[model samples]
Structures are given as C-alpha cells and as structure tokens.
Target: MKATATMVLFPELQSENDTIASQLLLLPQNITKNPCENDRTCNKDSVNINVVWLDSTSHSHFYRSMPKTVQILRDIKESGSLNVFSYNLMQSLKGGTYVNTVAFTSGKIFSRSYLQSKKRGIGNLFNLFQNGGYHVSMIDDLCWTWSAANCACGIPTFMGVKTQSWISEVVLGKRVTIPELWGNFSKELKLRGLNDIGASLANCEIMKANGITDPFFTGKSKVAICYNGLYQTDYLMSSLELLQSQLNRANRPHFSYLDINLGHESTGRRIQTLDVSLAKFMSFLGRQNNTLTFMFGDHGNKYGTFVQKSKESKIEMAHPVLFVLASNDVATKLGRDWMRALDINQNRLVNILDLRQTVLSLAPNVDVESFPINAKYDNHPNGLFHPISRKRSCDSMGIAPEAGKCICYQGRVLQRVSNQTGVVVLANFALGELNNKIQEQFLAANGNESSGFGNCRYLIGSWITNVQQTVSQNITITEMDIHIPAGTGAPQSEDVFSVTIQVGSNIPALSTNIKLVHHERISTYAVYDDCRDVGVDGDLCVCSATPTLQSWHIDPPTIFGYISTVINLTRYLYIYERRTPHGLNLETSCDSADKTFEVVMRITSKVNVGYSKKYPLTFKVKHGTIFFIDVFYQLNPKLNWDVKYDVDFKQL
Candidate 1:
C-alpha cells in the first residue's frame, strides 16, 4: 500500500466576493468523490493535502467576521487528514499607504467594495489558519502579489490600532472577533483594552506551541502552504529559519513552498540580500530523504510595476513560469518518470493551476485525474508548449535576425576603443657563430659600397652583448684586445693601433638618423667554452680571426691591404739527451701551433630616418678561419620605438 501524500493550494489575489466564494463552493464536491477508477485507494483515500485560501480582505475586521472560515478550517483539521493551507496576506507596508492615500483623497467617493473585500478576505484567512489544526502550514503572503490593488487603502493606519485592540482582548481571554463592516457595517471604531493586543499575541504563542517544526510533514494531517505578502529581508530570513527548524524538530518528512516573485522589488531584493539563507534552506531540503519541495513564481510581473498595466494583450506577462521541485529518496526512485512527465519539452502546458493536480497525484490513495479540472485538461502539445520556452514577438526594425544574442533580455551596449595598429614582424635567430655566418654570407654576396648596405639590408646590425655563459671550464683568457693598423704604407705596429679594443663591439651599420648622438660602452667581458676533452692530456686550443680599421673616419686608406697573419701560437717541445759516449746529444720537436688573424672591411648599409632612408658605409671586422663577422651599431639621438597610426572613419 502506498503512503498518504498531502497537497496544498495557496492562491494570491483570490477575492472573497467572487473568486474565493466560487472556489469554496467547488471544494466540498471535489473532496467527496474519487474521479479515477483505476486506483482502488481513490474511492477510500483521505484528504492528505488540504487547501486553505487566506482571505486577507478581512484582516482589518477579522475579530468580528472570521468565524465561518475559522470553523471551516477547524472542521477540516478534525478529519485526521493533511491540511494544505494557501493564501496571501495584505502587505501592511505598501497596501496600507496606498489605501490611506485613496481614502483621504476620495473621501466618501471611493467604493467601499475595494476596501471591504480585501479586509474580509485577509481577516478571514488569517483567523482560519491561526486557529486551524494542522501539523504543517505554508503562508503565501507578501512574498508574491505586490500590487497595491490587492491591499486595503487604510492598511498602514488601521493595522496598528487593530493589532493593539486584538492583543488586549487575547490577554483578557475574550473572544476577540472582528467587526462585520460589510453587511452590518455598524461596528464602533473605539480603541480596545490592553488585553485585546495580548490576546492576539497569545494566539501567536498558541500557534507556535502547536506548530510542528518539520518542513516536510510526510505523516497524516499535516499542512503546507504559501504566503503572499511583501517579504522584507528580515522577515524572509526568519520565515526560512522557522520552516527549517520546524522540519528539523518534527522528525517526520514535510515540504514548504515559497513563491519568489522576482518582479517585486522588496521580494527580489530579499532573496538577493539573504541569498545564503535560501541556499542553506535548499541544502537542508535536499538532504531530507522523505521531502519533496517546489519553488516558482505564479506569474511574471510588469517591468516598471508589480501589476500588469499595459492595454496590449501579449503573452509576455503570462508565459514561462519558473518551476523547480526537489526530492532525495523519491527523486532517486521515480525521478526520471516525474521529470519526463514534468519536462517542459514534453509539451506539457503546466502552469500555476497544475500545482494542485501535481500535489494530488503524489498523494496516497488519491486519483489526480478524478478532479474535473485535471480530467478535461489536455496536456500542452509538442513544440507549442514548453516549461522554459516562451514565444515573444519579433521586432519590425531592420536589425538582422541574429542581431540580438541574449539568453534573457537585451542589455546596455558597451563601447570599446581599438588599440591595435600596424603589424610588427620579428624574426629571431641564433646570436652566436651560426647567425653570424648567415649574416656575413648575405653581406659579402650583396655588398654595395655606395647604396648603404644597399637595399639588401633594411636595418643596421645590433649586438646584445656581455651575455653571461654557462660552462665548466674557461679555456680562453678573460680579456683579449684586437688592434687595427692605421694608414696605407705605415708598418703595422702591434702596440700603437688605430682602433682600441673598447671592451665591446663597434658596428656603424646599425646607426640610424634618430639615434646618432648616443652610444653604448662595454663594462665587462664574459666567455663560454665546451669541455670536449675533459680527461685528455693534450692542450685545448681555439682559433678566431677578424679584420680591423686603420682609422676612425670612413673611406680611410687601406693598410697593407688588410694583413692576415698567425696571431697566436703555443709550442710544446720535448728535450731528450743520451748520457754516455756520444757526449751531449740534443733533439727537440714542437707540436702543432694554434693560429688567428684580424681583417678590416668596409660595408654600405641603409639607415632609416623616420619614413625616409639614407645610405652609409660602416666599418667592421671578419674572423679569418671562422668565416663569420658580428656587427654591432650605435644610434644617434636614441630612437623611440613607439609607433602610432591613424584610422579613417570613412572606411569603417
């Protein structure tokens, strides 16, 4: 046998004069019979979930005219079935202010129906629920339905007076009944005793005393409903805590439903302000194995107001209500089936009205289809109906079909500035002998003395020197100087050389018009060598050669046509002399000699002066056997590499 389930219907904006009265008329008939014959329990099923529509209209006069509804609620509670209570309460804050303004301005001109209906409905609902005997309760109040039309004009003004009077009567143990302002319309508007306000508080205390803390009241005779009122942050926080605490204490499964009206400023802000509270509550619900919960908005509100004021008939205000239901154990067993049935894409036109049916379907021994509304209900057809999809009219503007790409709605456009300009091409190459050989080969083959390294070289060569090298052994001396002899016929003096080894490289081809005055001076030298023969007994040798300049000025006379000689040599000779008769015999032989040479050369290179170019000849040196030369240039009046560009708006 299946366990009994409960259903609660909480409706906001249900008027007592017409809507409420008609719904109440239909409830007794609906509750008496089982509409579905397939299920045997349908015939004998008890009402697990009860529906209580709060009549907030009577709040101002609840002490006098709330007996009927109160009696009805108590009678339902005595049946040992679940009581599902649902209703909206007056937003004492917003409604009261609006009501007072209208009453004061219109005086006796305003129809009494507006205030009378609201007062009666709210007063009756509150009285019924407060006195109703239900283990669980859901109050749908100011959280949803924030329109001023739903509230009384004198709410703010009358609530304080009424609350005090009600409290006094409660303390005095008096039956504090609201005045019958509608029919009799002749109740004295006098202040009540202190005991009236105390009585109301006493009722609250009594309700709290009987209230079960279980949020998911899975047992029989439990009540769950929604509250409709303007929910402030503090109120919501307290409400959630109360619900959570009740669920924790009840030790039985229960569910609490809340309508998050995102369109209501206070309600929306309440959720946002206390977001963590809601999260904690949801997490608690999720962990309860026996609980099933649902949250959603009844309908969307207008953009500027809580009420729909536009005259145009559009579905924008009616489409796509958000629905979320969560359960642990039940979901684990029948989650897929339930999801399939509830899936928006399955073409089910489920709306606020379907809430009752869904809850009834989950109840034990209840046939959801037996209800007339559920029986005649044709599920929304495929493609035409979806839970998450809503059809909106396309604009008639010239914008493209795919112009807007927003998931929710269009937002403000953000303007941005373009920071990209011309492309900067960078070609990185090895900085050692390999790159030097490539550059030297290109220069020697394309040398043009007059046209500035000619067109083959776009920019002068620059050196990134004093680079720290990583090696185990140092084979060469720490510092070595290369000297260039001066003038044509002058004997090449090794000591008095024209060019001084100024710590670093001197390459003129790199100089540009923008950087003609500045030059870099080398501070130190760094060297690296491969330890090829670590344990070998022979001396390690390295060879290098380069050309030098005879003078600082360009086109100077060539000295000895650039002499190349073996610059370095180290000999290791062996001396062996036999002792005896041959007197002293000496034989000496030397090992292979290490050699190096320097050669001077003049090359033409191009220098860029902003947008223009000029030809210049630069002096450089080349290695003898290595067949590579590294050229480094110094610029005059240091150049600023910051490039700027202009874009034509017309082109855009």
Candidate 2:
C-alpha cells in the first residue's frame, strides 16, 4: 500500500472574500465519480485521500464538538493512507489577544500580568495538543509580517505547534527496536550473530560517517503545518491566492490538504465567508479524480472583535466554529452512510483531541481500539446542546446566564478597560521624552544667537579636579576673555563682539591644533565721512594714540599664538586655525615680567570624540618664565576592555 501524505495550510488572518477567491482559483479542472465515498469499506477497498482543515475561529466549536470530526478522520485514516493539512487564520490577523498583551506589556517594569496571561493561554493550547497524538507543524505570520524589523521573538503565533513538535519527538516511537517476541535466548543470539560483530560494524560505520541522517524523512509524503502569526488583510488574500494557484497547477500533487485557524470576531466572520466560497471551489476540485480538500476554523471568538480590553474578558468570549470537508472518492464509497454520518442536522460537539482517533481509524489494517478514545458523540442531548447552549447564554457584556438584559456592570467593564490603558500611557511617556531632548539640542545648536556666526566653533579642552560632582553640575571659568578693543572701530556695528566664553567639562575634545591671528587696525575712526579718506599718518596716529590693536588666544596653541596683554586688545577667537593628525600633545610657552610664567597645558581636543569622561586630564601653568617643559602621560587603560562567554551543555 502507498503511504498517505498530508498538506496543511495555516492562514493567520483570512477573510471570507479572500477564501472564496482562493477556492475559485484552487478548483480542479477534472472530476471523477465513485460511490460509497463516505463508507469505511469503500474507502478501504479503493485508493483513499483525506484532508483536514482547521481554523482558529472554529477552534472552540471544533473542540466542543470534536467527537464527530474525530470519528470521520478515524474512518479516513483506517480506510486509506491519511493526508492531513491544518491552518490558523487568527495567526494572520494584525493582533491577537495574547499578542497584543505581549506588545503592550513589553519593556514595562510592572507588566508581568500580560506576559503571565499569554503564557497561560499558550500553556493550555500546548496541553490540549500534547494530550492528542497528532503530529503538529507551525508557520508564524508575525515572523513574516515583521521579517525586516528583526523582532526578538522568531515567531509569535501558534507556539503550541512548536511545543507539540518537541513532545512528538519524545512520545512518537522514532526508535528502532527488537520486539519482545523476537527475544534472544543466549543460544539464539549466538546463532544469529556474534555480539562483537554487531558492535564492530556499528563502530566502523560511525567512524567513517560524519553523522546520521534524520530517520523521519518521509520523502514526497512531507506534511507542512503552519499558523499565520499576524498577517494583514492583503497578506491573507495573497496567501490564499498562492494556495489556490498551487492547487490548480497540474504539475504539483493533487492530494495535498490545508488546515487554517480563522481568528475570532471579525476574523471569524471573514473565515466563514472564506469557507462558503472555498466550498464552491472544492466542488470544482471534486471534478478531478485524484483530489480531496477540506477547510475549517479551529476555534470561535469569545469577543465580537479581535481587539479585546483584557485577557480575562477574552476567556468569556470563546465560541464554537465550523468545518467543511469534500472528497469525491470517499463520498461515493460510503454512499448514504457517509451522508448520515456527516449530517449537520445531527448536531454534534467536537474538539481537536479527536484528531488522533480520526486519523488512526482511516489507516489500513488499523483497529479503532488500537488508538485511545477519551470521548465520542452519537446524538446525545447533553453532549450536543450542553456546551453550546451554555456558551450562548451570556450576552456581549458577559453577564451571567441569569442576568438576562439587566443593567450592565460598569465597574467590571471599566476594570477591564483599565487593564489595557497603561500601554497607551507608557508609549506616550517614551515619545514625549524623546521629543523633548530633540527640541533642546536643536535650539542650542541653531537658535537666533548662534545663526549669524555662520558656524559656531566648539572649544575642546579637559581639566581634572579632585572634587567629585554629578554630571548635572555646571562648570564656569572667570579668566580668559577674548574681546575686540573699543577704539579699533573693528566692525562694531556688525553683530561681532569680543567676549570671554569658558569651555565646560562637558565640552567634547578636539584632535587638530588651533591657531589665533590678530589683525592690526589702520585707523580708529568708526567710519570716515566718506569711508575711505584715512591717510598713513592717520593710520599711525590710530596705531599709537588710539592704539587700534587686537589680541587672539589659542589654547594648546600649535597653529596660533595666545595674546598675553589686554593693551588695546581687540581679541578674535579663531578655531581650527590649523590641522594635524589625531592624538594628545602638550605645548609650553613662557613670558617674563621680572618673573617667568611657564604654562604646560595638554592639547587634547578630538574632532570626533564628542563628550567623553574617560579622556579627562589636568591643565597647569607651572615653573613661571621657563621656555619649555617636559611632560609625561599614558593612555587610559579603562578604555580598552574585553568580555568572555562560557557554555556547558552537560548541565542542560
């Protein structure tokens, strides 16, 4: 017998229009007729094809009414090779209850509540799948949507699928074993093979090979299961279109199936429309002899919409969903029996747990008893009506079944709303701080006062003080005034002025040397009557009596000289007076007035090293009247550091 293959399509957020369009495209061009399609005998006698579609919007309904679905799947699995495909539409929706909770609470110091709630939901789903014996696969829509954003979490929705994969590895008998019936007595073991021979052969193979290939490789029978994480409407539409294209193409296999989760509320309504449209498309595909198809939502929405106020309220919003199946061969085999079994009029409640039973029952030569069955439904009143009726009893406000149109509890509703309110507040706070800093920096660098200077030059210098102060403290210096002298008439009316500005500790360093140049004035007249009538003797007179002189100061002066006296001192501060390579260098200058004044100042200014604390040093004027001074220094050792990583897999 040929092995059965299953293809599962997990639509994250699919709408009815999207599903219908997809179905139209997926419909097969040919059809074949066969009787007893639903009958177990007919299915087993002929080649069988089975497909399962699971959607998130129908999940609750499926779970509540799982017995019939399970029985049908079991029949398919038992009769022929089983092929299964599943999908989740909610995975594609922009936001889910758990996802929004994660987003809102992320990075918040007091937001464990949202995380805990999401974990709980995921944990419940995990438990449900693990208890069932279905092999699960997942494709996340969130990962696809934000592929360029580099989200920390790889995939966001259907985490239960990943957990189930892990569990399947442990529980599914993936190991080769010698049956107890083939038990080896000492004599039989010796007769079959020498123990050393088996061990030696294994050792030689291991030594020759790099590694063992995966034993689970199913070849062409590969089954892909996925869940749409947080997909947009357009994405869901495109995805369905892709699926339809694949199904219609003759070159590809016809037996593939799809499973999807249509999320709650709007997503659920959208999936329902998809189901109806896909049904028509499946009817077309049924024309093809080798094709089989099925689609359904996994669970229904508890709330009327995808967006909910709180996790607790969402719990109350759960509902049951619907499933549809189409297969030409299977329907003909069972004939009336198949119709009787699938009759929606019978009203059945089901859950995902029945999948194992359904698949096992469809496998060839497999006894139904061989697989475990926790529950089954066959027209039982309590079974069919109990869960659904109970769910419908509550209204939109989630009042108790007995409340029946009573005044809604405002407190309860408000509390739920409050739970999500914090997210908005925190987002606003972060944005506000970011805007404030941006505005402050813009004003300081480009305001009215600094505009006319063309470009304000930054003075870079460092000073080490024994005092320990917070970064908030402001540093100011009293000396070091650079001014344009009064009698120089040096463009005084132009907004240019000579003022002493102190370089603060917070100022960044510079790399190149700086020079200051002083231009002597020819006359002291503000502006001659005709503007150009000053003679040479008048210029001399301006230079002597008026002493139209100017001074310039350049610290760490390698390119420009610093002015010593304020006599007729019209000072101009010229930054970037010269350029040199990057590093720290010291310059010495001395002057005498019956005493030598020697200054040893560190010239540590970096063009690119903006505002750093690690490069702080002291500037001192020592040994007055010395022509030159010797200086010694070292690079800060704290600047160069490294970190290490250690891993111990054994502990794990």
By how many angstroms RMSD does model 1 differ from the true structure? 36.1
Per-residue lDDT for 1-652 in model 1, tens only? 0001121222335565653411100011111122343466432322212221211122222212234433433443354221212222111111122232332112111233345334421122112222222123333322110112222322222333343344345445676443422111111112110001101111222222335211111111023221222223223334444544443343322233232222322111222322443445544433444444443332222222111122110122223223233333444444565554454432322333344445534444334345344222222222111232333211111111111111122222222211111000000011122223333444455442211111111111121211111111211001111122222222222111000111111333323211111011111000101211111110111111212221112232222122112212122222222111111111111221222222222323323212111223222222111222222222122542322221111100
- After superposition, the stretches of candidate 2 with alpha carbons farther than 4 Å from their true spots are 1-54, 58-257, 261-280, 290-293, 304-319, 335-339, 375-652
Candidate 1 local distance difference test against the native: 0.25
Each prediction's whole-model lDDT (CA): 0.25, 0.25
The clash number for model 2 is 109
Candidate 1 wrong stretches, greater than 4 Å: 1-134, 140-231, 238-242, 245-249, 259-262, 265-271, 303-316, 333-336, 344-348, 374-652
| Candidate with maximal TM-score | 1
